[model samples]
Target: MAFTGRDKKWLKGPRAVALLAAGAAVVLGLATGGTVTQAAPAKPKPTHMQVQLLALNDFHGNLAPNPATSSSGNVNGTPAGGAEFLATKLEQLRAAAKAQGQETATVAAGDLIGASPLLSAAFHDEPTIEAMNEMGLDATSVGNHEFDEGYKELLRMQKGGCLDDGDGQNNQNSCPDPKSRFKGADFDYLSANVFYENTEKTLLAPYTVKKFKDGQKVAFIGMTLENTPNIVTKSGVEGLAFKDEVDTANALVPKLRKEGIEAIVVLLHEGGLPADPRAFNSCPGISGPITDIAKNLDPAIDTIISGHTHQAYNCSINDPAGKPRLVTSASSFGKIVTEVRLSIDLATKDVDRLNTLANNHIVTRDVPKDRQLTELITKYQKLVAPIESKVIGHITTPTVVRTADDAGESPLGNLIADAQLADTSTVTNGKTPVVAFMNPGGIRSDLVATGGAVTFGSAFTVQPFNNYLVSMDMTGTQIKALLEQQFSGVNQAANKVLQVAGITYTYNPAAAPGSKVVAGSIKIAGQPLVDGTTYRIVTNNFLSDGGDGFPAFTTATDKFFGGLDIDAFASYLSAHDPYTPGPTDRISITS
Candidate 1:
């Protein structure tokens, strides 16, 4: 739902304009004594409604730009993103639409909050919700990261209130704003497919209907990936059922049509991957789950705004009826915005499908920052400054990034795994961890350094889930089974190779999915793995409970819970003084 600043029907309509006394043109050629008179301009009545939807996705509370070294800091080699620039871009896009007599709504496909920078996540993302309000965001879908903190917290994000746990524990300083209370999202968070298992009620409103000036209506249905439960922590999605994305949206199409809303758009939080030569505005080739999902979608859906793959692509994948329907995604971290325009027939009350247009716009920083957003950011910067600027450690000149090599290992991933192992091995309460396994998905951002200095805030942004470390005992045979799960069963479609601190293994990427790991390639501490020997392994709770399609950890024994992963990382960084990116050679690849 794009937010039109005012009720568009009231702007310049016949009912709102004053009729001239003369009604038509007045002439100075009077019969006797003539007086010059001018007639008011005739207001042209618009024949149809032009609706513009300005959209963004996967913002992830990026109030500021990434460090120059971080890939997410910019787009297409140009400095882009940051809330100030994003707000300016949105305003510019909306203004352009308004000048054309088009109504506009700013929408998002979700990931607006959750794993955010310290400035936003420090106060439970209240600042982001406030920032969105100022940016005139009308609606967004509920993404998987929105559930990182649990559903109750997500409800709090929508309904607005003060969190009872504002004691500055676990990186949370909720409701620390001067107002002392959060007002929640001014925008709607549509959750069409997510529901409560008990009563079968949707977690949030299923869809939002936007009515235009000419009495035409459009519906925006939002949904996350159906496999959200498998990716998120169990407690976050506890008692909530995520139905198939296709079925949930299809069920709502007829419901909307019955109410005379034929122009439908889906703000789906799932997306596809663009093939080689991926450009921000056009797709050379497209494949992934979204390609199939879009094909199965009902023809009644006019447009689809997608995210979660964090890739930028604009395309028109065909609907079931074989007519091309617009499908678009703006890349993550507020770097891009998609402007979708549709011409709705005044007589038919539906979209002129052939006349629809869509494109992705990069939020370049050349424009002046929006004043309101600047003020909001400056205020939060002051509040978060103390914690954000505290130098906790130093890093090498070249930063350690989250980019993984062909063998599925990253320098940042290895660093985090080492930190976990270091944290667990020093504990006196349980057996020292023989290996530390980190699911690649948990490594959020890169370890970028400014002047070779890394701060607590930067670390928080890198690992913001605040997931606790859990250690469990398993035999070498069980460990082998766990490693196999990375490229088999649930992970075959999208494998997640674990980063390790105490082991090295080789695998054949082109081999059959279930047999990728080379025989006897796994080794722990330079020793060949023995099937009967027991070993202690450490990982975050999300992975231990099988998050990100890795479920083998569920059967381990003697689990030991430790402190926060962020703490371990920060401590490790400080203890090491000048941290360097790991060799990233823990995992090997065989042709």
Candidate 2:
């Protein structure tokens, strides 16, 4: 049905007619000398119901306010983000929708935990889950980060208790209270496309049906990108298989429709980037995998809420039947929340596509902090103070930032690569790694020294993934292939450049993808790399297992797992106090 600007007329039902007749009788009695009486008119049954969906995505557990310098934490150049502020905004939005006679549900597109800030990650992300439960999250799809600790650990997150293995190394089991236990998330975690290899069944509930008091039902189908295994650590998805997003979603649509659930919303963890960076609320020329997925979705699906790319945009995409459907995403780190309004037709039990609208609202820091969230943060902060405040080392200058250059090299990346190289230089097997590489995505933040001293929290924030350094042997030719892989195949669109140490190379960006690196340019300490010569290389486990589309590492031999990446970096900083930023001459790019 088409959305019109004209106000809908409310028709009186049988109950209202009966009430008016009763009132008329009273009026007649009053005219016949009986005392006059007044009766209130019966409230009319609404012909259609408005459902308000408050959606957020990629909230990587920033319970406390993020630093002002953090790009993701800012909204419209204002210091924003923090669970407290996010909670207040959600409450306000819910209240406003309620006032307008609309039912509201707060949902997320996932990445609610994993790779979180020091406060939440210190305790294995339990604090973040607890905070989300308090904020009244109704449901969320499983993002790739949810599989960071592996599927078993993900199950523990859903059905909670203390981590059975008790991560003694990182003190992940160090609860705020000695007797405290982590209570699982109160909301449902749906994963429609992920299936068990053994049983050939979905890993989690395919979808959840939300029923309103007025008999309006909407089905929420949740799933991550089908290529989850390629992005996450291989072990995390050992026994699981991710099916095609379009196929899985289309297959479920008929079942939901047969069950009388006409209104459907897909909570997808995969998202797209908007063409215009400034258009946070409007989708003008949006492009990415989400665009193709939305176009192929069944017409029965009403809206799609997505994440993973961590960009924001609200758009109306056409379904297979050429029907418009709302698709939206809120930027990462709880900085923005997308409010979607849907008008469901009572007779058809389907969304009135024309009447649907969505907008992204910033979670501004100007609002009052939520008291309960404040208390939660305070509790966790106090418990984490000792670890967070411990001095890790010192930085000689503030210029050592995480910002990558055109060639993908950065001072901080160089430092991390150096640290990994040093840590793997002398392993238990006595094999030394001659070169090291770090993924750009792993370097989460910059080493901004506060008064020249770097705190443990700062170090942890820089390398928050907790990936282990893996040393392996690869031929010089494979190493060159690895560099070329950065610009081709899966990396072509993402362009995930690798950070290097103990090696240097020059490349021409204008050259063909597989032939970007100049011949005879790859070198180690001024010596040209020989094609057949084998060399030991060190990198994080994520990359060693072919994560981030770096498949060249998967062919390496003589695997040796070393210390945690953060520890190696911290140790390097501690040993090299007053450390200066390294040169960014590792990778030279020529047009």
What TM-score, computed on C-alpha atoms, does each candidate reach? Answer: 0.71, 0.72
The true-versus-predicted C-alpha distance at residue 14 of model 1, in Å, is 47
lDDT string, candidate 2, 385-431, tens digits: 76777777888896479898888899999999999988842364567
Query: Over the full model, what C-alpha lDDT does candidate 1 score relative to the true structure?
Result: 0.79
What lDDT score goes with residue 533 in model 1? 96
Every candidate's lDDT: 0.79, 0.79
Q: On a 0 to 1 TM-score scale, where does candidate 1 land against the true structure?
A: 0.71
Task: Pick the TM-score winner.
Answer: 2
Error of 2 at 14 (Å): 48
The residue pairs in collision within model 1 are: 2-105, 2-106, 3-105
